[model samples]
Target: MTDVKPSCLEGIDANGTDSESAVERTGAKPAEMVRFTATPEKNGATVESENASQLDQATLMATRPNGGWKAWLQVACGFSLMFNTYGLINTFGIYQNYYTEQFRFDPSRASLIGGLQSFLLFFANGAAGPLYDAGYTRLLVVTGTILIVFGTMMQSLCTEYWQFILAESLCIGFGGGLTSFLSPTVLSTYFTTLYPLAQGIAASGAGVGGIILPIVYRELEPKIGFPWTVRVIGFILLATLLLPVLFLQPRMIPGAGRKFIDKTAFTDWPFVVFLCGNFIYLLGAFTPFFYVEVYAVQNKIASADLGFYIISTMNAASAIGRILPNFVSSYIGPFNMLLLSSISTFVFAFAFEGAHNVASLIVVSAFYGGVTGLFFALQPVVVIGLCPDPKLIGTRVGIALGFISFAVLASNPIAGAIQSRGGFVGVWLWAGVTTAVGTGVMSVSRLMKTKSNFFMKV
Candidate 1:
């Protein structure tokens, strides 16, 4: 259309070809206008209109959103990937049930195991952003699959707490983090204004996985034992994601080449505020992901099935939470969407404090999970809003997430310690307060971006 290809993948690929490649044909003279009888139809024309509709079809294709067959296929790949990684990760409650019984570890100590896994997942993704920008998607995806497969295989042999620390916490954490960061970047690079929708679609994979994996593990564990049950899930991930990598393209303009994001991009004020706010909000957000179900079991109000369901339900709700708000956001603005989600999260945390039964607990899990799910889906939009350069996007998000992972690292142990001393109310109240603090920080961060201006697009 513009004689320029899309820059969806911010960093360009080095080996791509265009008309310029004809110069190296090693002929004495190069033809100025190459033509052939066997040439395929130009990209945009519909068959019915033939030559007459070529320009019009080109314009329509140019204006199409990034949800082409390839892009959505990538989203499906993410769904399969996330289902395996997140489903297993959220099943910490399932693991925790036996972990305590088998190892005699206290809740506080066990929280560290789950906490460390989550910390690596989020924090390591900070680095993953840059690696992805350096043209590493295929590599990371393959590596992640290998790590997850090997980790699952090795985990079946574990007998001690530290074994999980090595196999599950570190291996799975690094594995998922690698895919997690790249998956979003891949979705965003292709989808322009429709990024939030695409991202919501991709992010929903984890939610589906979270919902299905717990049920799968729960049903299968009793019959097959933990080792084989876990190993079987590993193969499923390999099966689903292995083929799609071939169809995917980086979407960079032809002839453009890959380059790392500049460090100067990180110094922007809006990005800095985003970093801080995300750290505050996410630190509190991750606590429930890792431990809310464990709280249900510890409080003696619900059975172990309910504990597993807490996260499972939360994950299910999160899928909706991530995708549903996108339509409203197209009108209201993503920042507004984020602000409302943050406030609702704070409210949900407090609501959690009064819960004592399955119904109340389910509501808390669903609502809170939904609120946080929105945060993840749109937070990247906030980053892109602040800094629009594709080459620089990775740096800004990487740095922001790196800081956020610190809070992720610390949130659960804090929750576990509080639960130890004062039970669910104490931990939930702290979590609620943290959410409010995060909301306030995120709002202020936005204000800083707009020179104290509100209702600005970012």
Candidate 2:
């Protein structure tokens, strides 16, 4: 029998012990270690034998394709997935408006349709993660693509509330959740050193999609009518989604006998704390995106025509924010970037309420989108860093995002209630306060992980 020391396990815990010990401490069954030591010398394989020194594992990690045609192609695959999923969700407001105007439906009821879609978009992540770990990448992406395309087509024919809910919310949202979570999880396996940068580039697709899709809707609906315009959007998604479905592949082996729940992840204090901080941050993170244009129109700071494009401007700026900060994060560490962005976001939350003019409103929207965009891009990378087992990245991140889905679902209604009672100022104040608390929580998590080493890159 080949003797592999327990001390040389795949992942290191916060206590400086190997992941084997951490797994034992958590009472999880012994999982298969990474095959780095024995795999052939191709792609990411290292020449080190199973009996080689602990450096064997490190060598395997260092062999990742940081930047190459194949690796960059994977990044493109991730971008396509993001564009088809979250990017589509970003344009829901336009559909909500159309539904309310054409059918004279209650605004709150119409909002439910979009809210349900957004909720399931993340909520299905719990199952999505485990499925990915089990080597179901193609299944998830293929099924999700079919659902989204079919749902969009069905949405064109719907005239009733329940029909829209079934076609638009349930089908699209659940499909999006299944596919969206795969992007970061897959990217983590391809480029260890430039993971954050690659992920940022992929995530920028959301901002790009956000900017373009709404424009497509706004310009097309007038010229082609609602049904054909939606069909056109569906065609765009179909063309884009086919790329990821055909090309995106996982670089790592499937986890052998991985569990669905992954309780070991929750046992880690730093990860637990970080997960809580993320949930709290999400509770208010989307308030500005949700209401920036509303604030512009209601306050008469901008005309409806100009206000229509405020979100587009914000999303365009966010594309820059998503890519540039992430490139820097590769050197500074994702955790450090997370803290900086969280603090900046808190400041911007308050600044948003103080904007009393069109120029100021547009500027605040731009800056806020940039800051929050950094947070969005950094989140999955942070989750991957905190996890002890490389195999658990998908499950743990899925759990983290799935937990936060409730916050995204309720964020708008909570802000609306505050608006009714106290107006936009109260809403902004709430956003700032929640974000500040979340930042403080993440700071504590960082301190715990680094053992108070202020200079540490982590």
Highest-scoring model, lDDT: 2
lDDT accuracy of residue 13 in candidate 2: 39
The residue ranges of model 1 lying beyond 4 angstroms of the native Cα positions read: 1-65, 253-262, 298-300
The residue pairs found clashing in candidate 1 are 83-209
Per residue, candidate 2 scores C-alpha lDDT tens digits across 1-458 of 11111111223433555544644564543222223233332232123234333322333232344666767888999999989888899998889889999977798899899899999999999888987876678788889999999999999989999999999999999999999988888877667657888999999999999999999999999998999999999999999999988777765545557798988776889889988888788888898888888889989999888988999998888888889988777667788898999999999999987899999988988999999888998888888787766657778878988898998899888988898899999989989989999999999998888877777776
299-321: candidate 1 lDDT, tens digit per residue: 78689766776777889899898
- Candidate 1 Cα lDDT to native: 0.66
Could you give me the TM-score of model 2 versus the true structure? Answer: 0.88
Q: What's the count of clashing pairs in each model shown?
A: 1, 0
